[model samples]
Target chain A: MEDIIVRYISRIIVPFVQLYGLYVILHGHLSPGGGFSGGAIFAASMILYALSFNLSAGTKKLSHDVSSVLESGGALIFAGMGLLAVLLGTNFLGNRAAGFPLGIPGNLFSGGAIMVITFGVGIKVASTMITLFYSLIEGEGHSHD
Target chain B: MSAAAHLPALTVVVPLFFAYLMPLLARWRKSWCAATTLAVLAFTFFSSLYLANRVMSSGPFVYHMGGWAPPWGIEFYVDYLAVFTALTISGIGLPVIVYGIKDLPHELKEGVLGWYYTLYLLLMASMLGMALTNDLFNLFVFVEICAIASCAIISIKESRECVEAAFKYLVLSAVGSGCLLLAIALIYMVTGHLNFTFLAATLPGVMAVYPKNILAALALLMVGLGVKAALFPLHVWLPDAHSSAPSPSSAVLSGLVIKIYAVAMIKLLYKVFPATFAGMAPVMAMLLWMSTLAIIIGSMFAIVQEDIKKMLAYSSIAQIGYVFLGVGLASHNALLGGILHIFNHAMMKAMLFLAAGAFIYATGVRKLSQLKGIGVTMPVPAGAFAIGAMAMVGIPVTNGFWSKWYLALGALDAGKPLFAAVVLVSSLLNGIYYLPIIVNAFFSKPEGAVAKPGRLPAVMTGTLVVLGAGCIIFGIFPSLVLGLVSRATRLLLGL
Candidate 1:
């Protein structure tokens, strides 16, 4: 990963890939590509950065501890949304029935808790991917084979 | 809907929420992981009991997710059978976690303890989800979660054998999951419904038009669940995985985990598939014969295992066959026996595994031959093992007898005397393998590590005691659980 050209190109492209991931996650409720795909896209950027740089560099960028906390935090966000419905005396994951503002139908922040849940899933999946890559690389060692 | 209506969702969601928090808790407060797991499993247990009570008092009901009525959204159907399976899961699960609190740290690294709890809770939630979910796709999701968690627990030990065993299990389990997904797709294609009630309603009409598709789905469903359940022939993955896992993991894997698949299969076979369709395909007859082979062969293999845990793993295959035998017999008594065996075998196997764990913990002895006169030194674990062994042999006073009795009676009821003989021969095989260990432990002289066994934690000893007592108590008073078992049987048989 000492190749200057590869590292420089990845550094330039990573931001754009992440921005696209965010865009997909934000528009998830209104569009086809939701949390899972968007999250994978974002994770791909991080993986690319790691591959282009090095494992130690990747750990510095997203540290195992941070990625792990984000992993748990992301899922908590999703579950918390569902629990909010239960607390509100509706069924679990109840969207409109829980009386949260859905905002304008076609706009950002629309679709009530779904957008938030999607955002949470985005975080969960991205962090999970990064953590998996870091552990697999670190645990298995960086061998060409 | 009232707060009580939310019980089904809460039962699954609570554990999942706690599971996500476990690794963080491990980092911040390592001690909290075990206590939190115990508390979460306890909550699951009591809620399942409450659900069971409500079902018994009134009848079955459905809880829709997000207030979206199904055939459109996921639903939790809280019926006699659902509650029965849920109660079995949480009831057995709680005790296993209690045993694991003391057992896990001894086997696993200090840092990964939190991760173990996370996997444990996820496994708990998924099994409970599998029990209650009314939709086929939802069942598949839960099945996958259960499959993944079970494999992780095995591999978490990080030993060579553990890793290899887990890999074998993962491959077979993934194949099973694929078969299950394809079966669901087939069912969905013909019925245009994923909800169990809707599928059951529509399947009969579709059965006439799509005979081949329906039959293929049935075969795929059986093979998929059977592999997970370790129903002979397809059970090559079970012995290695179960034997190599840590004691508490072994207890749960052999005890509650595999049985859940059998429960799922029972639900699909009895509820989703029409009786006429089952009759047309000879599914029950096939189950009967396959179970017969599992019983005979699993025991024969068990009789030869030198490792105590491996023996117990093979024994689990045989014990599960009893449950399937009951299901296959299609007699009211036999089905009752099969369902009851699920509970009975879970307790016995868990107790046996924990006792085996205690032995290994104290003396570093796993081979049955090295365990001479272990009873003389470690009375508590040895006594529990004795109780479990007696249960496995289906002694008159143990809980195992009632299920075996019902299975045999059911065989007679179904006019299959040969299966009754199979039951008798299996019991003899059970006694042949299990009795010697007890006799040798009690009568032979203590030697080497057995002479001065290390101390067992009070909590570990306490769990074994409780499970052993449960075996005898439930054995003596079959009425305690029979009410639910009989009712579930009647409903499934459409009596």
Candidate 2:
């Protein structure tokens, strides 16, 4: 039954579901869903794929290397956003009036610090969730043939 | 315009960001790996020193995050105490990593070695983060990270006892974190602000308006931090956990982790809470009594222990009591003495743990009695250990003496000369247990021992020598670290 879900639903649903997750992340600054919520949703897409395929197959597709890089890149980008504020002669994490347009308050790119922080949270949640999934998989002694 | 204002946040970020980077670089060679960690720690250590110097020259450095300024965003405030903990964290952290480089091969296999370094860096980063963060909420987050990392590292050996110890640590820490979060949430309910300084600003209004809830939050916060600090009765898990972990981790956990929590408690007391509380003295007196008992009882426990590392682990509980006693007394000089002792103890304890690691590596013995004659063969490590023990026992010339001197003086200043007397007696007890190994190793020979020190590696001795030098330098020139402590203590006492 699990295999059937993997073969039938996941193969078809994974792509669209992940795209939706991305939408949740990008729209986080404008709406309710931000980095953590979107990242969790994105992870749900991959996790479903893993459930359908076996652990090794799932891991191979979403490898440790990818997760690590994503994690580091996400954090670096978060920090870079802060540095950008600093370079603009504002405070270290000052977002508004530091060059980037704050946009309208109710719009998509509305809140200054909120948007950048959302992206930071997005990267962190995505990579860390994946890492957690991998560790749990590895810890369960996932050495299937 | 000065760096002091932002120093607190940067102190946390540098190590923390390094922590996140380290695991990704895990596949690198051991030498390069150790070098990278050392470089990060050294960077952090210097930044702390620089910040401390700046704060001393200027005053408390306050950075309002996101430019929202205080009461809205978090306030990263660096006075003397925060800077002192920053220095202590990186100060001992670098040596532990240095000492770990030589001892790693023996404790861990090549495949999983990288994990050790990653977790070690995370532990360092978290401590630094916890030390410097001004947001009550952020402190909880960092404490969780430190807890998970330290728990993971403690069990790196895969031994049954290690697992059990780590498990105990995890459960207790979870409880502690829950209490801490609950308290912070309560504070938020009252003031709707998460920044400590902001909370302090509004606490009186909140308290005068609603006394019961504020007092309840205070109680919760104290209990939460008390468990983490391992205050006397709350310290059941510390000795076993410290003793069971591998050597370098044992050093970091004993010498740094609990002290940082104590610093946090000190911050909460003087910085956030109004000292004019009706029950302040009795509460402090309770802490004073508990810490005093912890010292004497901890030392007494140490005397009976045969396992060398276990003895030292118990000794740490006692030494921590001294710091607590000093701080709990509430006198300016007493607090200074306590804070200064945190630095002094880190150096001396790190030296002893590293030397123990060296001896463990060479002669393959851990019991103090079994280690009878290895000192004759391995003079450098033995000598290093002796110096550490002497410093720990409060010998007149060592750095440990200065902290003890200050503690004793502070105790006298607190008008409880008996506390000073207790410290003096405890120092003697410290000598009684710790001095024997040195004497036995050097002066009296044992029946069965290693023929000679079997190629004691340059790296091993190098770390030991550096720590030993720290003990001497800090001992003789107590003023060096005290300069940083006074600024911190001044803020804490509002003097």
Candidate 3:
């Protein structure tokens, strides 16, 4: 973990990795990659940072409490969007009938709630991966002590 | 736009919606998380009741998810059987959550209780979804959700044994999921459909053309669900998982979660497979033998267990056998008995587990031998456990009696008197294991100084009392449940 070349390389690479993850998540409606893969890509960047630096550095970037909140927030966003349709007197998760403006199909904002849901999912998956990594690694240290 | 039309979707979504909010609410106020969970489950319980009423009065009701019609999109199908199963799930869930409020703090470490509640709600939602969904793929997805949530709850205690048990349960259940996914894939390959009704309509023709493929799918589905349901030989993972889990988790996993898979299996056999296929395959005969073994062997194992929870876990394996026996008999009375047993067992087992949890919470004694004369000290839970045991033994005027009666009658109706004998002998075996626990708890001398019973929370005691009273209420007024079971049986038999 103390190797200079590896740390320097990861420091340079992590930002681009994270940018690509955001791009995949935002463009999910128009392309194949979506929330799950994008979220994994973003999580991988944090994991790389943890590997190059120490666990404490990783925690400084995304603390446990914040990651937990983000995890729940993502799920809430998805469920809230679904409930909006029910509140609007359509079926649960009914998209078109919920009165959200559906833009042109090929555009970034075209799919209305789909894009919102994918964004929520992206946040959730990324946070979940980080949280899981922290717990497993932190648990290992505790057991050793 | 009728409110009734949305009940099916709401029954599942309401609990799921709350589950998502649980962690956030816990971050704000831990008590709010528990309150939200209980409130949503209570709502789901009533929604299931209203849906059951609608199904009874107006026949089956179907809700297309997102307004997409079936054969393409997911559908929520609420038949007599589905509503009955959903009602049992949400009904049991409400009380378990109420019981959990007092019991969980003892079982879980600080700071992780929210996640436990989250998993609990998710488990309930997925079980309800599994019971109600008409799409084969949707059912598989729900099964996976239930599997993961159930495993997480088991490991929540964070003891070495709990973690090990959860790992074993995960691996075995993952295998079961694989089998189920493969079976669904095969069925879809043959018919190009995943909706149950559409598959049922198309399956007869596909079976006629490719009998072997249909049979393979049936076998895989049975084995897959059988593992999840802990059907006798496939139940090795169940005892450790159920006994080592935190009390309410054990209660839900043993009491309600295992039963839903059986319900799914029954739905598939009766609704999807044609009578000709059932007759040709010897599937019923195979189930008949497997269940008979499950009954005798599961009880025999229970008889030797020292740990009370392990004994109860083994008893679940036996009780599940009775349900499958009813299904395997495939007669009007037997199928009715099997379906009814699902409801009855849920009540009795959840009561027993919660009562056991109360006992553990009070005295921290889990061994039956250590429980000597403790019943005299802790009378309420002991009394409830007595009722559960009596119900397990099929005593007259207890709920278990009626299910066994119908199952025996079913065996007779099916011209299988040997199976009736098996049922009788199994009841006697049930008496052997259960009677001792009751007797030892009340009558035997305390081995050491009798530990004074600690005060139990009202919510915990109240849920036990209600479930205990339910055992007798349902037993005395069998008509309350018989009407639904008969209708469900008739639907299954196409009568």
Candidate 4:
């Protein structure tokens, strides 16, 4: 990882990779790309950063504690949304029946709880990937640094 | 809007919601995390009871997720069978959680307790979902969730052996999940429906046209669920994973988790497959032979094990054989016996594991040799273990006796006296392994310095007592569970 040229190139490219992931996550309902792929793409940016920099740098960027909290928080948000439907006197995870506003079709906010769920999933997946990578790498010595 | 209508969804969502909060609560207060977990499982237990009562009285109730109707949306179908299985799962889950409150701290590392509770709740929810879902795809999803959660909980022990066992379980179970998904895909390809009812309705026509495809689908589903259920040949992972897991996890894994897949398998055979197809297929006969081998061979393996947990783990494989044997016979009485075994085995096995855990917690002894006369020191757990052992041996007036009696009768009814003989021989085999442990625990004198029984937790001791009593109560009043099993079996047989 001491290759300066490779590091420089990754520094230039990582943000774009992350932006594309965001685009995919945001447009998940409108198109094929959604939470899983977008989250993976975002995770790839972090992984690339770790490779270019070092394991410690990656840990500094997204510590284990932060990632764990985010992972649980994403799941909680999804479950909480489902509970909202129940509290609203409908079945769990009910959308329109739960009184979530469905906006115009093909719009960003059109899918009611779908968009919210996708957002939660995206966060969850991205954090999970980073956490998994960090933990796996942590076992091996960061001798290169 | 009524709470009754919400029961189906709430049964699963309640556990999941609390599981999501577990880690955070653990961070705030460790005791709060355990309390919440117990509360969540208790809620699931009551909801399942209410749902089961409703199903029995009013017939099946289907709740479509997100207000969408079935054939297009995920549905929770609570029939006598589904609710019956759900009640067993949540009912067993509550006591195991109560036991875990005292037992887990000894097994898991300090910081991982929250994650353990979290995974435990998730496993319970997935099992409930597996029981309740009418959609094949949703069932597969729940199966994967249970598999992953179960593996994670096993690995939570942080021992090298625990991690290795968990990995083996993961790889094998992943293969099982893949096979299941492929089978569902094949079925969907032909029927163009994933909902069990819709598939059942259309399957006869499809089977008439493409018998081989249907058979292949059936075979794949059997092997897939067979691995998950720990049906003899595919059960290489069960002993290691169950024995190495933390005791409460082991109790759940051996007692309730494996049986849920068996329940799913029964649903597929009797409900999804057309009656004619089910009757004609040699799958049941094949299952009969495999289970016969499972019964004899699994018992033989159990007989030689020195480690008590490993012995019990092997015994589970054999007990699972009896359930499959019932399925294979496909007679009304045999099916009833099998269904009853599901509940009976859950109680006995959970009690046995918790008692084993208490022994470990009190004296740190896992080998049968070391257990010698330790019963004198810890009378309650030893007494519970003895009751569980008697039940395992199919002693009269124990719950296990009734199931075996009906299964033997079913074999006779099916004109298979040889299989009835097999059941009898297996009971003897069960006695050979189980009785010695109880006898040794109570009678044999300790060879070395006897470790004084440590202060066993009240909750842990109480769980064992309740389950031990359950073994006898259900044995005497088999009528309580038999009514449900008979109704479920009648439905399965389309009688």
Q: Name the candidate that leads on lDDT.
A: 1
Q: Model 1: per-residue lDDT, tens digit, B1-495?
A: 677779999999999999999989998998988899999999999999999999999998999999999978998999888898899889988888898888888999988899999999999999999999999999999999999999999999999999999999999999999999999999999889999999999999999899889989989999999999999889999999999999999999999999999999999999999877787788999999999999999999999999999999999999999989998999999999999999999999999999999999999999999999999999999999999999999998899999999999999999999999999899999999999999999999999999999999999999999999999999999999999999999998889
Q: What's the lDDT of the predicted structure labeled candidate 2?
A: 0.81
lDDT of 1: 0.94
Ranking 1 against 2 by TM-score, winner = 1
Question: True interface contacts reproduced by each model, as a fraction?
Answer: 0.76, 0.39, 0.59, 0.76
lDDT of 3 by residue, B211-267 (tens): 888889999999999999999899999999999998899899999999999999998
Docking class for candidate 3: medium
Q: What local distance difference test score does each model get?
A: 0.94, 0.81, 0.91, 0.90
Q: Give the runs in model 1 whose Cα sits over 4 Å from its true position.
A: A142-145
Q: What is the TM-score of chain A in candidate 2?
A: 0.84
Give the 10-residue window scoring lowest on summed lDDT in candidate 2 chain B: B1-10
What is every candidate's C-alpha DockQ against the true complex, given to 2 decimals?
0.76, 0.47, 0.66, 0.77
Candidate 4, superposed: residue stretches over 4 Å from native? A142-145, B449-451
- lDDT by residue (B1-495, candidate 2, tens digit) is 444345555666666666666666775454566778888788888888888778788876777666777666766777667777888888889878888887887887676677788788888888887777788887888888988898988888778888999999889988988999999888889898888777778888888787777778877887788888888888888888888888888888888888888888887777777777624435678778988998899899899998888888888889889888887888888888888888888888878877887877887778888787766788889999999999989997799998888888888888999999989989989989998889888876755545454587798899899889888988778778777787777777777
Chain A TM-scores, candidates in order: 0.94, 0.84, 0.97, 0.94
lDDT of 1 by residue, A5-124 (tens): 999999999999999999998899999998889999999999999999998888898999999999999999999999999998899999999987899989988999999999999999
